[model samples]
Target: MSRIEPPSTDPVNSKPARAATGDGLDPGGRRRARRYDPDRKTRILDAALDVLAEHGAAGTTHRRIAASAGVPLGSITYHFATLIDLRAQAFARYVEQQSAVFEELLEVVRTREEFVEILVDLVHGGPARYRSAVLGFELHLAALRSPDLRVLTQAWTRDSRAALARFTGPDVAARLDALLKGMIMNVLLATDPEPREATRAAIVQTLGPADGSRP
Candidate 1:
């Protein structure tokens, strides 16, 4: 039998292959360090929303979200310690995003008619918007069972009322908030959402006049 050759010492081939650091692997067959993504948290949060929309709060889990987010499982725990924490943060993000849109819509309202038109358009903004509305409802239902989530809901309501109060007075703003919630639910559940004119009429009845008065 040929004598067993000692390990190759050739400079090109004799070097023992470096062991992987267990960090990650690039496509080129070289080991790579785990990349840090500054926006990873944001991605995870958004993924959480998609998961929430697809699977109700009861079905959402860290593993499911991590898979959806394409993040390592530990990342979820790294950012949020518990499911409640994740839900709270995700809902907070959703509220902030929706509030920005609400503020933008309010910014363009120069007259009561325009305000009514905006409200009507919002109700009829279509399926994509309806998904967000559904998500909102999901969060609301969850908030009922979670004081932590209720805090977020409370802040959202306060901010929404404050935004509406910019054009309508505090009293009308409060009523309008309630009206909006009901109208949105009706719009989402109805086979055919109520007509813009019908929504307009409701607004007119509720606010009396959107004459840009903030009491």
Candidate 2:
């Protein structure tokens, strides 16, 4: 019988193969690792809000948020260096999205009655109202303890007041802002929530007639 030839061991003829692990270098010397996700930062910020809404700021952490975000733990730090930074960005996003919703709703209101109806709908019922209510309280409470967060809250208040000022004038808009805040809190927390009509009346009372006449 002829002797069987051993397999060739020549590196020059061998096919290129990737590293089993580590840096994932291929035989051709190129890295074969997964490409970085461009939207990972936004995902992390959104996940941070979901975590905050569910667990409050105290319960939000890199590991928990990483799992929630479906990202590597390192990605959290890669996007936001500190928990406070993550919270701030998440809250900023929340405020921006909420403001956009308000703008959309307010844009279609041609009269004071329509504006009151919109505010009533916002407090009594609307999309994501309850979830936003919870997150709003979480952010407000967190801001109490964080001066940096308080700045964001103040900015949010200024924006809301500015939006209301378009209809209520600056003086009434400030009071209306306060009224809306209180009404929202009551609607979210009270065992017997105020009726939509009652809320509307309260708004009208605070801001006077929505018929263009200043209160």
Candidate 3:
């Protein structure tokens, strides 16, 4: 059963006695309708993502997510059938959000140098967040074990590479995507990162001089 929160009291006290809850009628054994919140599910999913980023999939629980979301435990069961279901939906939401982040990185690139610099910044940790990396790592690990998650992973990879392929072509974009992932992981784990110039040089080396060459 859900906990009924007590309503606020007025500064001046009245002669008449009042019920603890203003949520519904108290006397005469009256029943009340459930409260409505249109955005509760979205908030739950967002909270689940936050949980996933902070803790791995294994550590994410319905109670944990409910507490993070400030929703009731019943809400978790109401929205998702199982923990795996909730985790999978949360992972999907992360991918959707990250797709936008990835697209924003390439939105203003009109030159090879601009692209190279963006890649360099990415390699050197520009807009990327520790939380994003943690979520990505958890998603990848989960996908490895579940074929269902692999579908989402594959689609994300395809879209990400396609975005890059707009500038670097399919072949180089694939390699660059792989390189970027590796370099990001290296940067995340390294005690001290290499010079920013080294990152730029690596990107420039990957792209080669601008020839407007067609594959």
* CA lDDT, candidate 2, residue 111: 70
Model 2 spans > 4 angstroms off = 1-34, 210-215
Question: By lDDT, who's the top model here?
Answer: 1
TM-score of each: 0.80, 0.81, 0.81
Tens digit per residue, CA lDDT, model 2, 1-215: 11112122234433333222434456888856756699998899889889998899999887888899998666676566466667778888888777777778888988767888888888887658988878888989987877566766776777788888888888988998888889889987799988887987888898774454632
Q: Go through the candidates in order and give each one's C-alpha lDDT.
A: 0.77, 0.76, 0.75
- TM-score (C-alpha) between model 3 and the true structure: 0.81
Superposed by TM-score, candidate 1 places the C-alpha of residue 140 at a distance from the truth, in angstroms, of 0.6
Steric clash pairs (candidate 2): none
Report lDDT (Cα) of residue 175, candidate 3: 84
- Residue pair clashes in candidate 1: 169-215
Clash numbers, per candidate: 1, 0, 0
How big is the positional error of residue 124 in model 1, measured in Å on the Cα after superposition?
1.7
lDDT of 1 by residue, 1-215 (tens): 11111121234422332322432556787856657799999999899999999898999988889899998776777676566667667888888888788888788777777878888887777878888898999989987876456766776788889888877778888999999999999988899878888988898799884343442
Give per-residue CA lDDT, model 3, range 111-202, as digits (tens): 77788888887767644476787788788899887656776677678878988998988888898888888887888788997788887777
